[model samples]
Target: MSSPSAAESFPAHTSAASQIFTTVLSQGPLTRSEVARRAGLSAAAVTKAVRPLIEAGYLVEDVDEDARPALGRPANLVRVDGGRALFIGVKVTGDKIIGVLTDLCCRILVARYVPLAARDPKAVLGSAAELVRELLIEADGLGVRVAGLGMAVSGDVDRAEGVVRYSPFLEWRDVPLAELAAMTTGLPVTVDNDVRALTVAEQWFGAGVGLSGFALVTVGAGIGCGLVVHGKVVAGAHGVAGEIGHVAVDPAGPRCHCGNRGCVEAIASDDAIVRQVRAATGVQVADAVEAAGLAHDGVAGAREVYARAGDAIGRGIATVANLLGPERVVISGEGLAAYDLFADHIRDAFATAAFGSAARCDVQTRPLPFDEWARGAAATAIQSFIRSDANQHLRGAALTQPA
Candidate 1:
C-alpha cells in the first residue's frame, strides 16, 4: 500500500501543533480564540501551529458571519478535515476479530468480523494481517492510504512495547505483536489493553467526554476497569493499571485465573458465574448464556449465583469509586446480556458499599458492540500518530530490540 500523502501528515510534529489539532478535533469548528482558550495556548501559538495544518489540508477554516465582531471581522472556525487520512483498527477476542476502517476523525466507515480458528499468537496475527489487508483494500477504494493500525487485546499488554505481555484468553506471553504486524501490514502499529483503548475512545468521543475523571467497568468474560484520572488514561509504571478484576473481594472465594482467590473476576466473570451456577444448581450449565437463561427462568440456585456475582461486581466498582472518586462509572461488556438478573444487586451493593460522596458518582450502563472495541483500537492509533514524541519514546531500543 502507498504511504499517506504529505497533506495527510497534518504537520503534527510539535507538541503545540498536536495539541492545537487535538483541541480542534475534539471541540472543533471553533475560532482561534476558542482553540487557544481550550488548549491553554496563546493566540500566537495557535496561529503558528494551525498554519501548517491548514495549509496541509488537514484543517479547514470556515468564516462565521453571525459571530462577527462590531469591527466587521468574521470569526473563522477551525476543524479537522476528516478525509485527510485513513486508519484500521482491530479488536481481537477469544471468538472473533472485529475490524474497522476509520477516517482521521476516528469515524467508522466500514466494519467486519472474522472468526478465530485458533488462539495462538501466530494464528491471531495472520488473521489480523488478513483483516488489515482487506481494510487497506477498502481504503484504496476510498482513494486514501491507511496511515496506521491499532490492535486491542484483553490482558496485560505493554502498549509502549507493542507486546502482549500476558493474555490469558489467547494463552500468549511476551508476543511482539506490533513489530510483527507492522512488518506484515507495512503500517505503524499500536497495541494496547483492550479496555484502556476503549476508555480512550470513550474519553475523547463517548461517555467520558469532557469529564475530568471517570471509570469504565466491563463485566463479561472478565471484570475489566479502565480509569481516567485528571483527563488522562492511567497506565501504571509497569504498563498495568485499573485491574479491578484481580482485586480480591473475598479471601475465601473461588480462585481466579490470575492465581488470586475471591477476586471480583473470580466471582463475577462469565466463567466464574457459570462455574458457580453449575455448582450451586447441580446442573451442567455450559456457559454464561445458559446460566443466564436458567436464572431468568427463576431457578433458585442460578438466580442466587447471579446475585452473588452482582454483589462482587458492585463491591469492585465501589472500591474504584472510593479510590478514584471519579465523576461517573460506565458499566459495559457482553455480560450485560444477563443484566436483568443482577441489576438490582449491583445497584444495591454499590449503594451499600460506596463511601460518602463517592456514592453520588453516576453509574450507568451502555452496551457497546464489538465494533466499538475496534473503533477504540483506531483511537489508539490516532493517539500515537498525533503524539509523535510519545511514539518515538515508545519505539526506543529496549522496545524495538528482540529478547
Candidate 2:
C-alpha cells in the first residue's frame, strides 16, 4: 500500500497565530474587531496573524454589507475554511472502534464502525489502522489529504506523551498509542481520554459553547466527568483531573472496581446497576439493557435499584456542582438509554444535595451516540492542528521513526 505525502504545512506556528485561528474556528463569521476583542489581542496583531492564514486558505474573509460601518468601510467577517483539509478520528471502546472522517471544522463527513477482535494494545492498533486506511480512501475520493488523526480511549491517557497510561476497558497499560498509530496510518495522530475528547467537541460546537465553566457527566459502563474550567479542559498534572466516578458517596455501599466502597461508579455504572438489579430481583440479568428492560416492565425491586443508582449519580453530580460551581452540567453517555428510569431520582437528589448558589446551575441531558464520540475525537485533531504545542512533538518524532 502506498502512503500519501504530508499536506502543506501551516503557514504560522506562533502562539498569536494559533490563538487568532482558534478564536475564528470556534466563534467564526465574526468581524476583525470581534476577533481581536475575544482573543485579547490588538487589532494590529489580529491583522498580522490573520494574513498568513488567509494566504494559506485556512481562513476566508467575506464582506458583510449589513454590518458595514455607516460612515467609512465595510466590516468583513472572518471564518475558518472547513474544506481546506480533512481529518480522521477514532473512538476505541471495549468491544469496537468507532471512526469518523471530518472536515477542518470537525463536521463528520463519513463514519464507520468495526468490532474489536481483542483487547490487547496491538490488536486495537491494528483495527484502528485498518479503519484509518478506509477513511483515507474516502478522503482520496474527495481529492483531499487527511491531515491528522485523533484517537480517544477511556481511562488514564497521557495526551502529552501520546501514551495510554492505563485503560480498564482495553486492559492496556503504558501503550505508546499515538506514535504507533501514526506509523501505521502514516498520518499525524493525537490521543486523548474519551470523555475529555467529547468535552472538546462540546466546548467547540455543542451545549458548552461560549461557557467558561461547565461539566459533562457521562453515565453508562462507568460514571465519568469532563470539566471545562476558565475556558480550558483541565487535564491535571498527572492526566487524571476529572475522575468523578471514584467519588466515594457511601462508606457502606458496594465495593468499587477501584477498591473503594460506595463509590459513585460502584452504585450507578451499567455493570453496577446490572449487578444490583440481579441481586435485588433474584433473576439472572445479563446486562444493563436487560436490567432496564425489567425495570421498564415494572418488575418488583427493579425500579428501586434504578432509583438508588439515580440517587448515587445525582449525588455525584451535586458534588461536582458544589466544588466547581459550573454554570451548567450536561449529562450524557451510552447509559442515557435508561435516563427516564432515573431522571427524576437524579434531579431530586441533586436538588437536595447542592448548596445554595450551586443549586442554580442548569442540569440537562444530551444523548451522544458513539459516532458523536468519534466526532469528538475529530475535534481533538482539529485542536491539535491549530495549537502549536498540542501533540507537535509526537508528530515530529513519528516522522523520523520508521513505519
Candidate 3:
C-alpha cells in the first residue's frame, strides 16, 4: 500500500453524490435545480450531496448576482473549488516523460518534460521521478498538497491493479508501476492506460462532454483508441478494451511489435511510418519527424507510405464504427502534424469501408500535445479521488477511523 502526502477525504460517498459533484465539476456554476435536472435526481438529493462537499471546501456556493431578479433573491450557484487540492499526472512515452501539476478541477498549473535515455523500467521511473519532483516543488510554492499521482502508459495497463501488464512501446511486462511510483513519490498512485486516461479528460471537459457514446482515437508513436459506451469508459474483462491499433487490416503489410502482421499500428504508427519510409525511399531517417519532413518536401515514396498508413487507419476506424456505431470519433495525437499528407486517403478509405449510417458518425481531428496527455493523467487521479469505488482504497480513506 502507498501513503499519501496529505490526508484529504471527499465527503460525498454515494453514487448520487458523485454524479452530482461530477455534474458541477464539468458543467457548473450550476444552480441546485439545474444540477438536479441534469443529474436526474430530486432537488433534495442535490442539496444533500452538495452540503458535505461545500462544507469540506471541495465546492463553493455563491450568489448568482447576474441572475438577481427585481423582486426576489438570486439563486445560488454551485461550483468545484479548483484550488482545494492538487494532483500530479505523468505520461510516459517511449522516449520522454511528461509531467504536470493540476488542481482538483484538473487544470494544469505546471508542466515539465524530460527525455528518456532508455526504455527500461528503472530508467523511465528515474526520469519520471525527477520531473515529478520539479512539479512537486511548483506545488509547494503554491502551498497546496498534491493528494495523488497518476501515471499513464501505452498498451495493456491494468488500472485497477495499478500495473503495466504489457507495454510494447516500453518493452515492459508485468511491472508494478503504482507500487513503485508510490514508494518513490510518497503519494497515492493510479496507473492507467494512456488513451483511457485521455478519455476521462475528454469526458469531463473536452469533446466528449455530454455525449453518451464517443471514441477518442490517437495516432502517433502508436495508434490507440478509447471508447465511451453508455456514458462510461469501457474497460473490458481484462482491462484491454478498445485495442483498435491491433485491428488487423492487412495480412502481408508489415509486422507489429505486438507480434501481429499488418495491424493498423504496423502501418500507421510513427515508428511504422519511419520504417516504411526508409524501405520505400531507400533513405535512412532518424525518426518520424524526418520522415514527415521528407514527405512534406514532396518525396514521392514518403507520401505514398503515409497514404497507405492512412488507409489502414481509416479501415481500423471503420471497424470501430461498424462494431459499436459511436456517436462521434475524435482523431487526435502527435500524428495529426502530418495529417495533410494522409487526410484525403483516410477520408476516402473510411467512406468506402463504413457501412450505411455508420459513415455519418462524425469524424473530426483535434491536436492534444504532451502537456495535455499529462493533464489526462491528472484527470484520472481526480476521477479516482471522487468516484466511490476508488474512495475505499485512497490512502487517507484507508487510514481514517470511523467516529
On TM-score, the candidate that comes out on top is 2
Instruction: Give per-residue CA lDDT, model 2, range 78-106, as digits (tens).
Output: 99899998989999999999999999988
Q: What would the per-residue lDDT of candidate 1 be over residues 44-102, giving only the tens digit for each residue?
A: 99989999888888899887788788885678888889988887899999989999999
Q: In model 3, which range of ten residues has the least summed lDDT?
A: 394-403
Per-candidate local distance difference test: 0.87, 0.89, 0.88
Q: Return the clash pairs for model 2, or none.
A: none
Highest lDDT against the true fold, candidate: 2
* Number of the candidate with higher lDDT, 1 or 3: 3
lDDT for predicted candidate 1 compared with the true structure: 0.87
Q: Candidate 3: which stretches are off by over 4 Å?
A: 1-6, 65-73, 391-403
Q: TM-score for each prediction?
A: 0.94, 0.96, 0.93
List RMSD in Å for every model shown.
Answer: 3.3, 2.0, 3.4
Over 173-215, each residue of candidate 3 has an lDDT whose tens digit, in order, gives 9999987887676677888999999999999989998888999
User: Candidate 2: lDDT over CA atoms?
Assistant: 0.89
Candidate 2: 10-residue stretch with minimal lDDT: 394-403
* Model 2, TM vs. native: 0.96
> What is the C-alpha RMSD, rounded to one decimal, of candidate 1?
3.3
Off by over 4 Å in 2: 1-7, 395-403
